[model samples]
Target: MTRGYTGEVSPGTPADVRELGTLTISKLSVGPMDNNAYLLRCRATGEQVLIDAANEAPRLLELAGDAGLAAVVTTHRHMDHWVALEEVVATTGARSLVHADDADGLPIPSESLVEGDRVRVGDCELEVIHIVGHTPGSIALVHRDDAGGTHLFTGDSLFPGGVGNTDQDPVRFASLINDVEQKIFDRLPDETWFYPGHGGDSTLGAERPALPDWRARGW
Candidate 1:
């Protein structure tokens, strides 16, 4: 039942009770880095897709529960985010989904995704938003509701208070900030929910007012 997090908490274990309208979303905080793995299951169709699949394969598998896993979507080409990628995919026989730009680094075969592409989990459609900077192919999956509510799954792009780390690369940092501002902040409403790849949750409203300060910091 703990789906959208507005603050940080030591996530206990994998759970499948978080309901998002007709869909069910579950999370498992795995790996040494505490990477978060999420399972988005369509309650109507019993089909699901996983995000990250970082580590602790058994726990992640269990999170899949009875819902059929259709695919594994990697937010980016981060080592922490996909350390258990092969393990999860092999066991589930799920297709690996990665952005086309970051596909070269993955150890397994993956079908490349791009901006504006639609990924279906059961009958729910998730739109891919390409966010470059944290990693060239980093993407955010967005679920919009008929009532105008929105949920954004941002891997390492936009975080609770700032954009993902850029290794002090000014060019990369600038690009990331630009995309987060123009593509995300400028476009999405303040009420949109943001679930980062690591750590807890935050809303666009909570983080939006501080964008200027974050940009100036050049982190």
Candidate 2:
């Protein structure tokens, strides 16, 4: 089940919540452009994990509460994804985790994560899968089972109706697309839910059918 909170203006801005089984994903709109940030919580243990601080640390902290944060995970080092990292970390005191390739670009550089690595929060585990199309170090997080379903936290790689832009290096974009097809699409069950960086949530089942068309359009 999913829930949404809109236009509840707070000093730090409030976020929308989507409950999936034992996990609750809080989607926050932060920064000047209202970049999306996520908070994943294990309902059973009350432990939480944040993804991409973006901006509005206070709001995120308020959302995280005293349940305490386990870690702050980033999909890449883009400024939009980490601009408010310092404030969040300072407020929550959570460790920051990112792909090793993009660790140098982090706001508060800390431990690095590699492909196939798993980060655990209470009884929940997120598998890190490198899907580097938007950036050399971009990645996606997959949770095998949560509330009787699978979930994916796709940073900037795969969106609801499209994929990340290929404006950087053509070769890199090609490689990213290939990785998504083989590593992500091929391996995961179609029922998986997708929590993208900047759009409404979708499922692997909802997205797979559109891949061929997206690929044909050279996205």
Candidate 3:
């Protein structure tokens, strides 16, 4: 069966799995907040990594199964994003990782991550990019597939419509959008697919035309 990557996932629905030549990305929605959690498994080595325990540890752990997680990455310090962090880490013994700025907010201690860090999943690796404003230490992970396709895991930093909320603060909003533009939009090709924390996924190309509108609106 050929599965599509529509990026539409509901809390109780099954995960949407996107299988690349060297990696498998399974995305699931969990908790009342509708946080999206991603499980990345390497095809060659069978090693896995879970991004954002989010909520519903039982469901996330069930999805992980016996292979277990090598690490759990928290995108930011938001409570909703890490509601199930402690439990999932306890059960899987996965190393906990979060950006340095948000590290203090997590329930458990984590290895501090920064830009240019590579997170290994068996034979595959994901590069980390630091995005500011949404949170002091918000970070996004970038993965390049075997076929040269780029996949981005943006926590609450970059969404489909615009950047994450900065409470309408102009300074923070500018900081976020600028960083996103320079680091993400300018550097990555339009075909790059981005997976966000809350809602559906979108290609950078789909949103490129809206940057001006988003900046003007001061969101």
Candidate 4:
């Protein structure tokens, strides 16, 4: 159903929508950092879940429309990723979900999430994947459609060309790359399409060849 989802977004721009079989995904960029916020709505039940309330509470709420939101999943503890979290949660009264390791950083208390857990939007389910090293609690959501197409919402963990910034620490870089390679690259096929916290999107197959270069650069 995604006629032309280029995944290119910027602050103040309208969200781009992608309609999967059972679920609809809308990507919006907000804040000065251009942090992406995804709104997932279930076509069958009209239930909705927001991936991140990065900023622009009013705009995000507007994007949610009458259905509002069932929950907001913060990908990490980074400040930019949750600038509008308090406002969105306050306005919608939606449940807040964050990794246990980074829950303390949030403005409001949230349900602790971990690997193997699933977040539901009506009948659709998104599998949680805990990717460490980015912030000790960064997580990505995986949604596989009925047609076998896979979509990944990678926070600041995995990106187009390489893993997230590890602050130039070799150990952190190692941890991130290793977990990304094993937990993501090893398990998922090359056709997997990934959406990131900022900018455009890319497929695993397009980025697969650069795995060694990213690991070797130690970024």
Candidate 5:
């Protein structure tokens, strides 16, 4: 189901999904930018993965609870994305993980991830894909569930109506758009659910129709 910035995806206690095997991806709105911080949980094993700890440290810590926070993954090293990372790691004692290209932004040491790198949390395995338009180290996490649906965690590379901005170099924006079209847009199934770092969740099917317009608009 598509979710917006309204209420939490699953309010109260966690809800279990048979196919996902206790997996939950909760979005936390943070900073003045409305950056998205995801809380991924493995229901069976109670293992968790926190993505982009931007802010709201107290709430994040409470959300993590006693689960074994396996890793803290960052899509890039932008200040808005990594600002609260140190605080989250300190509170949960979870190791931080980022692409080798973006590892310098983290407060602590981080492992370099690449396209084929697989991160396991409980029964779920997230495959890493590098789509470097927004930043040199931008990455997306793709997970194939037993229920036959694909979940894509696109940090800042691809969004609902646009792509990540090329703040450092305008030329890189073209490369970023090309990467999203070839690597992410074309590879995933039409039904794939896209969980972006900002805005609401949309499907590959929903976003596909707008690609040409986005490209024309130079997004």
Candidate 6:
């Protein structure tokens, strides 16, 4: 069974929960933008890693559960994505990881992360995949399960229907699309489940076939 959610969130409660084998993923949708903050836990050891401490500190702390957070990773340096970074990190005492290029934009100190780096939750490993588009240092994390499928935590750089906005420019859009197609689509298997920074989840199989359409629209 899934864990870490109270399931009765009003304005400030844990969003939702899902179980994927050894992992328990909890979400908190906060802030005026409705940004999503994710808490991923390794069930065996009760170790956790929080992705984008977007907002609602009290709610986030509640969602963090008893596993104790191992780290907090910023998907990018967008303002909307980190309102409670200081409070959350201060409360949990969890290390913060941000891409080298984007670390400067963060209000708090963080370790520099590079491509291919591994972020651990207990023994579970998540590989860093940098897809530079929405921001100079936008990134996604990939976790492979024992069943051979993968879970991709795509921040604003990717979503269900289309790529995230890139200043609404064709050039920027193309760059993001190229990076995503080459880095994520080409290398990973189609069975991957994409957990975006906002909204609902989608599978690679559900999205791959629409690449051409997305490219044509130039979003």
Assess each prediction's global lDDT (C-alpha) against the native: 0.85, 0.81, 0.94, 0.92, 0.78, 0.84
Q: How high is each candidate's TM-score?
A: 0.93, 0.90, 0.98, 0.98, 0.88, 0.92
Q: Candidate 2 vs candidate 5: which has greater TM-score?
A: 2
Off by over 4 Å in 6: 1-14
Task: Put down candidate 1 lDDT per residue, 1-219, tens digits, no spaces.
Answer: 354633343445545245667666676687578787778887778898999978778888877866547999999998888988898888888999999999987879899999999999887888999999999999999988554378899998988889999999999999999999988999889998878898888899999989999988997
Candidate number with the higher lDDT (1 or 2): 1
lDDT for 115 (candidate 4): 95
Ranking by lDDT: 3, 4, 1, 6, 2, 5
What order do candidates take by TM-score, descending?
A: 4, 3, 1, 6, 2, 5
* Model 4: ten consecutive residues of lowest lDDT: 140-149
For candidate 6, lDDT tens digit of each residue in 50-132?
99988778888887866568899999999878888999899889999988989998989999898999999886889999888
RMSD of each: 2.0, 2.7, 1.1, 0.8, 3.6, 2.7
Best by lDDT: 3
**What is the C-alpha local distance difference test score of candidate 5?**
0.78
TM-score of 3: 0.98
Give lDDT tens digits, candidate 3, residues 20-129. Answer: 88899999999799999999999999999999999999999999999999999999999999999999999999999999999999999999999999999999999999
Give the lDDT of residue 161 in candidate 5. 84
Which residues of candidate 3, in runs, are more than 4 Å off? none
Candidate 4 lDDT for residue 88: 91
lDDT of 4 by residue, 65-86 (tens): 8898999999999989998999
**In model 5, where do residues sit more than 4 Å from their true spots?**
1-22, 168-170
